[model samples]
Structure formats: structure tokens, C-alpha cells
Target: MVKNLYMLPEGLPEPVEDGACDHLQGLALPSVTRPATSGGSVDLSELPGTAVVFFYPMTGKPEQPPMRGWNKIPGARGCTTQCCGFRDRYPEFQALGVSVYGVSAQPLADQKEAVERLRLPYPLLNDTDLKLAEALELPLFDYDGHRYIKRITLLVEGGVIRQVYYPVFPPHLNPTDVLAQLRS
Candidate 1:
């Protein structure tokens, strides 16, 4: 119920700015299919056009405690806020011929709860097996027996990654940043 403490935590170092995404640009979209929170499945290889896929670690249930050390792991927190940002900006992204999606290593059922609770406009791609993470070589961290993908956004055009937004801070502001990148 509390805001992600790490979004702008006063003293902690930001974990995402240290060249984590340097190798990600121009990476071909991974050919994988995963269940979506909305229904059916989303095939990365089959995305029609420009697609915005924001990858986050996980979302915590309101009634449960987050994974151990969730707040201490830089870039590990704020999936919900980040998703909401994309939700608010879905219209703009859609107008630009860009389809927005959220990806995480959570179960489809958990993702469905988030979609329903947040009223997300887009489907959340479920990657419980971390297959997509392995395919993309995305940053990963483990906690209490679970592995989570680090928060990063990919701008894929024609099935190739065009831009990588790494170290997304203040997670809710990410969609606006993505819009700027697309416009420029």
C-alpha cells in the first residue's frame, strides 16, 4: 500500500546508470510466446509494428510483503507504478502506432490481478519461466528463491530493438521519457 520507497530514496545509489544497456540496442526481438494477463498469448516475433515493451521484475500483492530485499535492490522496485505510467500513456503510444506491453517474470494469474487492480490498458506478458529473460540476456536478480528481471524498456521496431531505456528511475516517469525518445 505504500509507494515504492526506492523510487527516489534519498541516500541510495541509483542502480541503472552504469552501462547496463550498452549491449542491448539493436538486439533482435526474441522469438518467444507467452501468456498474457488479458488472455491468449503475445508472441514477440509476431508483434505487428513498433512495440514498447517495458520489463519489470515483479509486482507485489497489496496484502503480502514484497520479496526479501525488494527495496534494497536498485531497479527492483516499482513495477506497479511503472505499469500505471504506461497505462496512462497508452493512448499516446497507440496514436503513434506503437503497441505497449508490460513484461515480467510473474505468473499469469498474478499478472492478471495486477491488470485488473491497475486497470491496465494493455496486456502483461507473463514470463514465469524466464525464457524471455534468457533469450534476451536481460539483467536478472534472485531473492528468496525467485528470479526477477531488472526494469528496462525496449523500443522495438520491425522486430529489432531500436532503443534501450536502462536504469529507469522514478519509474512512473518512464512512459513520458519513452514518448520523448520516440518523437526525437
Candidate 2:
């Protein structure tokens, strides 16, 4: 049911292929500029070439009501795996002229902490409001006593979604899966 809702219409939409993820996905992400830890909500519509945006969950605190318990998500494992997978194989994507980026609801402080802790070479965007995730209309889990972004990956080209992955086991996101898709 969810997958069907997210399926592309045969191929990329003309307007999106014109350099936007707007038609392929929806207007949500295209209109919202998520404040990156580096400062700014990058316009996904103008993204050049192929790129990957990974979304995760966060539990913000008062001062930074957007800075608490982000790593608490189960999706973090899958996220980390996918992130490192990309990092390890980053050169491959670059060689192929693809850009790679990661997004999460964690605050910049927390994101920086994780990046430093993991020693990742790439920058991670902070999407604590879950706005980015919501903009994409991605499945979100909230019940019992937890809230987290379902592990998801988007293969975007010229700002349009070439492919999307959901129900991805964050802790064990098969890099090969992404590799094969990206290679395709």
C-alpha cells in the first residue's frame, strides 16, 4: 500500500526532469528548505546530477528543542551502515559523477558529534522537524513510545527521484542494494 503510493509514474516527470524532485515525489520537500547544520535549507530542486538523501529521526531538547535523543532511533544503525557504505564507496559515486548527501532530524550539534565520532568525511543535514521526511510523505513509525523515520534512501537525478528505497533495515542496509541501483 505504501509502496504503491510512492511509485513513479512510468518515468521521471517532465517538470522534475527539468531539474527538480518536485514532480517525482511531491511539493513538500521542494518547498521546504531544511536548516542544515552548516546553515541553510538546500533547494533540492536545483540539485545537480544524481544525489542521495538519507533521512533519520531525532528527539530535540529545549535549548535546541531539536537536539535530543536522535541517536536513539533504530534507524540510526541502518543510517550509519548506509552512510559508511557510501563513504567507503564514495569515490565510486564521484567517479560516476554522482553527488552524495545525508539528512536527519538531529540538530547540527548532535549531527556534528556523530560525524566526528564516526569520522565521516561528508556533511549531514539536520532535519529535526521531520519536515523533510514529511515533505517526501515517507512512512513514519510512532506508537507505544517511539518516533523514528523509517530507513529510506532516495536516488535523485537532476532533482527528480530515479528510485526510492523503503523498509530498509537501517542497521543492515545492504550497500550492494544501493550500489546496484546507483550503478544502474
Candidate 3:
């Protein structure tokens, strides 16, 4: 049976807030250029106006099984669902004058595949080098010899982080939560 990549399994562990992102609020984005699925690269710090950047560990492909004990990790699952949620709500974000970007440590090729497969309107920034993660001190975890960023969302305005959403539970609802904050 093919696992549904867009659905989260029942009883998935919820991540607890660890204050990892507390220092991010009101922080200026660093000048780091990351390759994007849309081609070339984007410097989040140079972007004008409002933007939302959601960081997830990694997205699983249809053909491949997820890493061992993937779902057991508190916040490791649901990347695909999270991305799809953002994709489905892209129009709303655009209408609100906010740009959306997803970042992961995945390579650009993998990100491109996900963009084409998921029909994502916004680009997924490649953070394979962890440049942005290092600069911001984003939460990270190691699994199967690979390092992954924890799920977190940032509301950026004028190159500054205005809001930080850590421990985003039920990843699919994250977009809704962000929209609510943006609307308020």
C-alpha cells in the first residue's frame, strides 16, 4: 500500500516548545543567499515587505519510504502536509501581500522534485549548507547521520523577524494559524 504523503498518521507525537526561537523575534535577517526551487537564489534579508518562511525537516517522496523511526520523532513527520497546506493557501497569502517560502536542508534537486510534484506556487529555499540556520540559530536535530531543522515559522517584515511560531503542531493547520496572525 502506498502511504499517503498528504495525511498525518494518528497519534503522532506533539512537539513541545523549548524556547529555541525566543531570540528570533525582532531579529534582523542575515544576508544569506540560498538556492531556491524557482531557480537562482533568494536573500531573505533583502526581500521587501512581508514574507513567511516555514522551516521543516525534510519532505518524503512517494517512491521512497521515510527514514527509520521517522514518525516517532516528535516533529519530524508531516512535512509534505505542511507544504501542501501552504500551497493550498498561497493565494490567500498573496492577497495579504505576504510572500511565502519553505526552507529545508534538502538539496535543490529534491526540492525541485517536490515543487513539481506538489505544484507548489512559492519556492522552497535550499539550506543544505545550513547557512541561514546557523545565522539564526534555528533548532535542529540529527537523525540517521543527517541534520534537520525543526518545524518553525517566521513572519518577516522589512528584513526583520516580527513573529516566531515554534512547535507548529498538526502541520497542516500551520498555514491557517499564520493567516490568522497576518489578518490580526
Candidate 4:
């Protein structure tokens, strides 16, 4: 069964600062369209206004445990909690005229499971080939023979990236922080 790692006594580790990705500011969103857990293609370029795209490493499955040495990787845990945080604040984000999406290098099947299990309102984009990570030069980590994306959030407006939140820690608290930023 898929255990709720978030509730486990040994949950995700605190993220280490990787510095802000100011260099990515003003960069145009990638034109590539990817399959989403919600059963549609997510075309970043097609999103006209504000979009909050949070890149997470991977979501664990109830039937499958995380890869070996999962806890040893910094910012590698808490994908579920992070997704749930966005889910809880989804309506608030919408009220602010913003759209939220979770992106990861995980397969479509894995993402779908997370969405279904967590009842996530937003779609989770699948970048199994690491295309988005490559285009944005997002950090990558390899564990248990699988490549994963690091945790980060991007604020995109009018198809252009406006701001980036790097080294997100305490994953469940990010939505509030992002909401505050958007409001400010």
C-alpha cells in the first residue's frame, strides 16, 4: 500500500538554499506541451496570464516506496504535502487571477495517482524526459537509478516567467507564502 509519507515520523528533510533563479526571470515559457494528470495537454505558452508552476521531484505511490536513499537527498521529499498545500489554497489562487500547476519528471501514471489520491484541483504536468528541467536549467538529482527534478516554484505571467522561489522548505507551507507574494 502507498503510505502517507508526509505523516510518517521521518518526513521530508529541510531544503537547502540553492539561491534564487533570477537568471530565469523574463525568460519565455517553454512552448512544449506535455500530458497532464487531469487528462489534457498543458501548453505553457498558451497560458495567457499568471501561472504558478511548482516543480517537484516526484510523488510516491501507495504500492511502491520511494527510491533508495530518498531521505538523503535534500529537498527530495514532500511532493505529496506540497501538492496538497496547493490544493488547499487552489480557490484562493483562482480568486487572485492565478493558475497553479505542479510539474515533475515523474511519469503520467504516477502523477495521475497523486492527483487522484490527493484530490488536487490543478493538473500535474509530466516531464519524464526532463525537457522542462533542461529548458529552464532546473536542478536535477539522480537516485535509485531514476532522475528527478528539484523543488522550486515559478511565477509566470503572460507567458513570461516573472519570479522564482528556490529551495522551498516545509513544503506544506509554500502555498500560503506564494499567495502572499501574489497578493503583494
Top-scoring candidate (TM-score): 3
**In order, what lDDT does every prediction score?**
0.84, 0.57, 0.95, 0.84
lDDT tens string, model 4, 1-184? 3566665336656777665465787899878888988787888878988999999998887678656777777787788888888998999998999999999998889788888888998899999998878888888888878888889898899999888788888778889889998998
By summed lDDT, the worst window of 10 consecutive residues in model 3 runs over 62-71
Candidate 1 residues 17-73, lDDT tens each?
777678879878778999888778988877778999999988777677545556788
| TM-scores of all predicted structures | 0.91, 0.67, 0.98, 0.91
Residue range 1-184, candidate 2, lDDT tens digits: 1221111223221111112223444232365665554456576667887787766453222233322333343443334556667677777777777776777765678777666655566667766677767767666666335555665667787777777665455323445577788776
Q: Which candidate leads the pack in lDDT?
A: 3
Q: Return whichever of 3 and 4 wins on lDDT.
A: 3
Model 2 worst lDDT window (10 residues): 1-10
lDDT of 3 by residue, 1-184 (tens): 4778989999999999898899999999999999999989999999999999999999899888666788999989999999999999999999999999999998889999999999999999999999899999999999999999999999999999998999999999999999999999
Q: Whole-model lDDT, candidate 1?
A: 0.84
Better TM-score candidate (1, 3) = 3
RMSD of 2: 11.0
